[model samples]
Target: MEEGKICRTNPESSDQVKAVHMLLVSYPLQGHITPFIKLAYLIAGRGIMATLVITEFAHARMIASEPDLGNERNKVRYITVPDGLSEDERNDDVKLSQSISEVMPGHLREVIEKVNMEGNQVTCVIADPMFGWAFEIAETMKLKLAIFWTSAPGVLALILSIPKLIEDGIIDTKGSSKLDGKIQLSPDLPPLTSADFLWNYSGNQTPAEIMFQYFFGIHQNLKRSGWLLCNWFHELNPLVGNLVPNMFPVGPLLASGKPAANLWPEDLTCLSWLNKQPAGSVIYVAFGSITVLSQHQMDELALGLELVGRPFLWVKRSDLIKGGSSKYPDGYEERVANRGKIVQWAPQEQVLAHPSIACFLTHCGWNSTMDGLSMGVPFLCWPYFADQFYNRSCICNGYKVGLALSPDEYGIVTRHEIRRKLDSLVADDGIKVNALKLKDMAHRSISEGGFSARYLDNFIQQMKE
Candidate 1:
């Protein structure tokens, strides 16, 4: 497990062992990076060489968090490419997406060519579908391409149904929703409104237009992709399999023997703090990586946590507040200092898995949703945007394992509402029962003879062919 060494198969092994090498390209974001890394470890465990490619900025953060990230023992090699954005610009979704589309394709091409020249020929290219250009490169190089859909399969189904929506006059070619009421995709699934559309931007039409075009391009590319892999299980959303028949669900891709692929160094101190709290007594609050709360909203959240009067662990990222200053209300820290622990970032999976965690107050991002569900933690959902709304619907309505925090007239989830939600969430035994049920299902999905296990095996077998 030496540093700067690429772990390979043993030379003493039989030559019949096909050197199946996979190149995984992740969209440079925390949520995407974690599952992609887990996928790399999973593939490497199966006697395949997994080369994970990410942006240079993300790589630097990853290395900063874990100095020896891709050691030989992990059996995964790491590579970095320029994302063509400055550190500050990374926060802007539109700018970041534009840069990735414009700048990353050539760099990805160079990486592929260089890897093939090094004798460890990349037999397959597995990439996040956000980077549609990867498909073009793989096609040009005559390499097999498998797209990794990081979000919920339901989200994918929704995106893929865009054409139908347009044809039915529910939406336009530009991806805008024409309806004022909620639309039911199926009788069994939760209903969604126009706001729940993947490309829906509330106020800014420009960003919505940009995102629509971006996803539309990805949608077109998905048809030609050799394989479609999702980071979820059949039991979580069984209807997704019927909706997107070609997709293979092989996840809940949680961390295993290796450290979590975190962009920020996790404060392990929180684990020790959780150890002291009573079982199922603490609320875990985190809004994932990209959610930026307004200053007033941040203050309200702080007051809300205090009002809940429960032991709480909150992950307050450095860039959590919109304008950067995450200042709290007057004497807010002093009032809740004894019961609260705040960190820049936490080991989320471990936190969610902890016995002290009663419920989660989350942004309902797909990765966080999977983590919460797999850990069997009931949720107090506060979704931000895009697929998050859909994930919230799954949590609140479909699965019935969580409750959504309704915002006040001003579009802010006030302290009173937060307190009420937390109170209700912890009191509801039904929610807890459902959460545990999902947890068992999630674990079973990855175990032997499970749907995810069989699909993963099939995917690896396909790689050999």
Candidate 2:
């Protein structure tokens, strides 16, 4: 870890420097950026000086949407870096992993040099796992860099196993046929087939190559950091977290007992509809910002929710349709108008917190899954890509907190399977009891004296050391 850059020439002015200054770097994608911002708010609100680094494009969106975050801008100051992407490439069209791989390292170095020159002096950097060059930036600045997986511990464990899988000759560039049947890699982890580790849709590398490179990068980076932080709590991943001791489970940080911070506007207004339903009466579905669905899949999904007959809130982003406007079948919205609330996006935290949200229908993106678990809502996992399938298995089997949706050979799930899982999850009395129990534990982890709280305290202390 590196010490701060000296800004004040006057000895008297040296006293003005804040002891804890953090430069928070995220993967620039919406799913990755929002949670990191929330965590930065929690840290800044607690008296630490924090600055959030964003790409030139995201910087504009933040100021326009969330102006009051910092006195500097939104409580979290901004540093704009060039993404090496043109305006056309900046849209949601590019794949996330591909976008990350293509990002230039020059802007990140420039941001560090500029920060050192400005003299605010960063003590440590919290870097997203996907932002691969952050370790190099930390090395250059000599600052302690901590990696935030932004995913669950179970996913981390599965990713960590990639190196071992390669050594065992179970995976290769083309992928393995070993996943054709049930397999148990970890004694304590859920029974997962090889498909769980498959990279599926990430554009940069094949499934096997992606898993190998991602984990290889993660392990090497961990040795350089002050400590690692996960957005999960002990109650949700006690077994895995304990196995990986240096990793801290410090989150479920949204709407954390402090007070509601409405950074993003409440679109969709699904809460009003949630209020009208009975406790645990609805299934909330959101696959996060990047997961796109085909027209056939969406229609099947609609038929599934309709078959379940439970009230539901589903986020259908403008880009969600793969072939664009033609994806929505004739009268699709009208067909589910009575039971489903179809919105572009919903206030996720509020929707999850609502008592009516019984189960979450998700793609297992780290942030969304953590939010749902933090509220103690069980899941119906429909993982789209990357480590999501691994995460889905972890939730469904590792912790028994959710159920997995098994699709057909083409990876397309039918309405019958969806309805079967939904009824089994929401109707079972044990699921609700388990959900409430998990929720209580999640709250405790983020509370003042909880495990995650203590872990965060120790992590900061290491940076000071």
Candidate 3:
């Protein structure tokens, strides 16, 4: 943010380059795109040029037709490569992963060639681990390659220790643990049950298997990478950050003046509604962009919120329910009309920062977790899939600033259970204090001369030299 300048330097000669120009690449998912865009802004803030790369389909979906980061200078450029499929074929996670591994590199290579021919050489590429295949293209072009892991460093530590986890028979080749019990991936990290592992929940083994292989590839490439950055902060996860090499913890990665890269149009009306509510009285609910609930589960949640009878803003995404319309329980809206505001989407970071927000009811997606931490908002974790469960563990168990809502045997958070957790969270003064303390730590990590700023500055300096 150095005066919000957009610096693009052309090479005076091969012997003396002026600035670092990075190609920031991310997977098509909203989780991936959010942090990648923030990282782009972070790099560009240092007056280093950045071009954000994604699939043409993602480019159109998440990225609006407007210029990248605004008109005129457009400091960051947006480029797209075909994902080698029709819009219809891109939704299947397994197939999409395969397509990216096998098909995306060639398309990305062409884009790189085009950029080089235009005179701006791509000095570095910062990519999500999901785009591990890009390593080959970087090697082919002899470009500097870095992996931008858009998740907690604890997860990164575990993923890097897969070889040991396998050798010790803690986890099988397919990634399911050999024996189900409390397990510690390493002495320094928190103890984890099989629930923390992303693969166990997927009854289908293909995605799990693919993930295992991806972790393996990432670990293999870790040491050889030009640099590996995590969307995390050292003060937040001191132990894990200290243990991992090239693990520059420079995050809670956010860009000021830029709205979150929302795929769904945000219903900003909620902010006005929040303005009218009492300070620290509203419960903010959002389960990130994905994580659709079943009809039964949705009904339960609707009942639960009504039962809580508190001022709340719920981001019931248009796709909140699978196969069912985003409808409330019968007369649900009227029942809680005075206390609840339901929007398809809202400005999340803005909502969290608002004085009216008390605690968050979230699925514990990493980005949302970071947002909550950044705002000092305590949480009620209701994880649905993937790393969310692990993220929930980090928030509620590791950080001790949140509470977990356990679903019953049928995997539904009962209305009674929801009410109980909501009451418990609102009543917990200790958790609120812990949350604010964590928030101070988070802010300290990003402030001048702090760990995040130092790492970011070091990264830019490394890329420049």
Candidate 4:
């Protein structure tokens, strides 16, 4: 019943006692926050007290979207720290990274010390490796520090291979790709190209040198982390274990029983619409939080969906189109009004789990990919940037449960291509079968006594010690 103490069973009595209290810190992005929240719930389910810390800007959006977020019924406690940036400035990756480095460390240290003084001794800090500074703070406090990889194991593997890639003359020290060909990190993994380099996606939006140093710093911190936790199961990328031996896979960390910790308000009306559709007869389309489409591409996609003539639910975020309003082809809405449903956002997990959902047309963000995969939905991949192209390779080539949409010389995925890919994805019985098999494996990995469950238990036990 005291700080830094756990109950032990004796000959006279046996009792369940709180073993540890963990503080989870994530980069204030939707993709990163989603998994950290899930992991918090997972830890609390094991009788450990969990606290999740986020930037004040993200916290405000979350509270506005989900007013009941911090209710007492929730097992995890939530905290917010000033990120030292305006809401608009946070949209730029380089500015966000700079502000976080300059501002968040002292605040995080205060949080840990305050929590310790309040009788819940902070046992460990599990953080997104992107926040490399947390490692130093945890070290100063003499607490165990672990890094959580929020993306695919393959992405981590690719980051781990940066030195080798530079040695092989595939990339420069500044993270620029010297060659534009395919590469295979391991025979067991999917092949990638220079375009998939994590830092190369911004394309002049952020200075190359700044982005390069940011990612390189993260890579260095990952090597120094006491433990590495990834949000994927072993079966998904078994070869990554051989590549990064310290990595622990304890996920597909999806939320259950509580409202999702989403930054945007979800349109629950879509669920009722999904119920009206026939089983396996609807397309579920969403491109995560950050993908911005070109007007040409948006027009083409709208027409393609009309061509498919299937009942579809699409998440058309207000910021979906770049540099302008999100506008579709003339009368496109009226033409498909009877069968199509469009909303600013939807409860993605519930929509995917619905029996009426057929396949996912996705930007291939890791969280969206896992959601679709775990639900047994086949995919029509339209990766936007960052490691998304690599995730697409895993979905299409490594797992054989998805099909990639081809882009033309002008760099647009044409309307015809979308229609064709969807047709192929739906007609292929093999892909459907593989998708269900993958779903079963995902479910089993997270179940009791399963691979991920055992790894999670080991992680919790280590924290307890």
Candidate 5:
């Protein structure tokens, strides 16, 4: 059997490659699950059989959002395991950290056993690293286990280094959440201030202690997984690649061409709006599904767009602001009438690919940044939290593809600052050209004959063998 190539069951033909059966599990968060599903689609498209497992709550959203997925009936089946929480117990605002760790693994094991009983041999278990218990399950079943870290390799390196730093007594429980002093990382790594290296250790534990415990658990499982899949590409992080050759960079796994809508309430009318704009003239802004903006911040953003005077499309989810619709600025929509377009949810890939998209005003979420880079759009980076700060640093510092904006003490991005940064990021023709060049490079990396495509083939080949 040829490696990583898709094959069919034809008795008459002798060119069949062994099909790898994969069980993919994602954490319950929307941001994490979405990317894994896209990767599963890529794998399934290559003739590998992939079963995607999600929590019951997440499964409902998937089915409700994209019915075409056809749970358990499609080429990629969807299985929903019990969340070990009552209907009332599942609240959107509360912490789900414990349920995923303590409850999910048992339900997941039962599902694995059931599938095995039904003659579906699970060749490998691919799970999110946050679901740490999966490592134990895979070991028990003697299946090859691969863990996916939905964060970047650079972030992972920082995560893995915490234990060593703790042992050296450089960081401990008594300090501030962010490091007080600047420290040099490894010689090869790009110098990041201590603040830049800090993760959001915001739960009950002290900052240093939190990082200590988190990294300790992660390192133990890191050794168990046969492979690690990261949502990064070589062009973005060649330095990290040199450090960890075994780590697979199979992404920016966004829609190559226009992808079909994964969730509903997609407003296709925005495409028509794009047609009227000149080439590379519109700013595409979306803060992703989870991040919420205060009503005041939303108003400031609106005014900021109005101040910039660029044609723009902003995705405004109805549930975004904490309060109700009353929070929206009075006469804000009417004020930006002809120049701006606002929709609830959008077909993001199509928007990014459009010739009219000049820049992306983003929250610096990894997926959005990758998508923007895939299409060659420069960014106005407003990093919210968790690895997003690191992602912003990568683009603005490492890639020269963006301009960063600092929010106020209250975390509000004022209109004046927005206007200034937008002008600077969009006006530089050389930066624009560089961004386009990077975009083309990113596209090529994911194409059929590219490095990322080959890596996908290699991983599958290893599994089948």
Candidate 6:
């Protein structure tokens, strides 16, 4: 494996091999980028020429860290482009999403044209639907395009229901979801309320305004898209994907060979930490990057973890505290010295897969949900925002594989409450049983003739056609 320029697999080619080339463009965020890179690796390994287009920051970081992208035969070409952002603005979630949506289209078009100039054809654009501008560019170029929605199928169903919601007067022209209580999206599904709306933004914040507009734009642009590739399976949300036409449920897109884009340096030291613990004993606590807990919330969490009095590995971001100060009380670490390992980040997939990890206190992000599901870990769902609430609903209400934490009046999970949930998660065998069954179904989906395998095959074949 060598690094300098990305290359096609072989110099010699046939017309058939040249016929199928794909360009995958995801939003410049960890959640969107990781799975698409995994999808790129999968597509390329299946003997198609696939290029993963990412922001310059992500491209540089991943290239320096991962060797799999440079390996032979199953190689994916990397197209690095300006994110129209800076080092500082990268952490500003609102601006980053807006910027990626604005800048990526021109950069992506350049890659498409460059590939054409090289005498190879780029037949399709598999884009993360967050950036709807890709829909316009691909339409103008007349390239076959698929909306690679990275969230759950149920989330997609919610997005698609916007027009109907407006028409039914359940909501207004603005994206404000107004309802007194839960309403059924379908007969088979559980009820949803105003709370489960993906971008249930309060009034007049610019970022929230921008995000609402982004979702509306996605709704409009996706109308022209003939193919919708969901990064989930039929087992998860059979109704959501099937209700919508040309929907291909093709995932649980697990990392197999090439490690998907990891921005944070994973502390592999955690593996050794797990080895010392008894099987199914350590609590794996990680909220995905971008979730910031308030200072009080952070303080309460620390007290709660100590109260659990169990071995735990907690991934704590430096900016987790609101006032930018340590939330832990004096002598806290010494008191729980051998009981916990708190780092800035850990290799989450590996941590979730570890035998000693008994329960996962997760943010309920799509990737985290999938990782927990695939690994058969019982979940303690504590969602902060966005699709997470819905994902939590799916976990706790839909699948019955998790327990939801009840927050106090001030929206904080009190120490005693955390302890109780942890106790329930540890004591409950039914949830664990369901989690294991879901894990087996997830594994079987990627096996021969399984749901993911068949649909993924269909999707790639559509790319060729």
- Residue 128 miss distance in model 5 (angstroms): 0.4
- The list of candidate 1 runs beyond 4 A from truth reads 1-18, 203-207
How accurate locally is residue 412 in candidate 1, as Cα lDDT from 0 to 100?
Answer: 93
Give the CA lDDT, 0 to 100, for residue 371 in model 2. 82
- List model 1 lDDT by residue over 1-465, tens digit each: 222223333232233233677899998888899999988887777777788888878887888897667566776778778778887899787789889889889888888777677677788999998777898898889888999999876678777887888999998988878988988775556887888887775744466777788778778877878688899998877776766656788888877648667899989999999999999999999998878899999999999999989999999999898776778898888889899999999989889989999999999999899999899999999988778888888899899999999989999999999999899999999999999999999999999999898898899898888
lDDT of 2 by residue, 83-169 (tens): 666677666444545665566466666666776666767778899875668788787778878888776665677656666666766
Residue 243, candidate 4: alpha-carbon lDDT: 78
Q: Tell me the tens digit of each residue's lDDT in model 3 across 1-465.
A: 111112233223343333467888788888888898888777766777778777767666554622243433435667767677766677678788778777677767877787777677888888776666777788778888888888775678777778888998988887877767787654545677876776666643456666677677767767568688888888877777555666687888876557455677777799899999999999998998778888888888889888888998988876788876866777888889989998877778889999999999999989999999999999999987777878887888778889999889988899999899999999999999999998899889989999999999998888877
Candidate 2 lowest-lDDT run of ten? 1-10
Give each model a TM-score: 0.94, 0.85, 0.92, 0.93, 0.88, 0.93
For candidate 4, the per-residue lDDT at 410 reads 95
lDDT of each: 0.84, 0.70, 0.79, 0.84, 0.73, 0.80
Location of the lowest summed lDDT over 10 successive residues in candidate 4: 5-14
TM-score of 1: 0.94
lDDT of 6 by residue, 1-465 (tens): 222134434442667658888888877777888889778876766777778777778877766656455565556777678888878998777788778778777777787887788877888888877667887788899899898888876677777888888898887777776678877776546678886776674322456545666778778766778998877778876667656888887778877635668767667788898999999999999998767887778878888999998999999977777567566877888988887999887878788888999999998999899989989999999987688888888899888999999998878899899999999998999999999999999989978899988998898887776
lDDT of 4 by residue, 107-127 (tens): 888878777776677888999
C-alpha RMSD values across all candidates: 2.8, 5.0, 4.3, 4.5, 5.1, 2.8
User: lDDT, candidate 3, residue 275?
Assistant: 94
Backbone N/Cα/C clashes per model: 0, 6, 0, 0, 0, 0
Q: In model 5, which regions exceed 4 Å deviation?
A: 1-19, 71-74, 86-89, 92-94, 173-189, 200-208, 257-264, 323-326
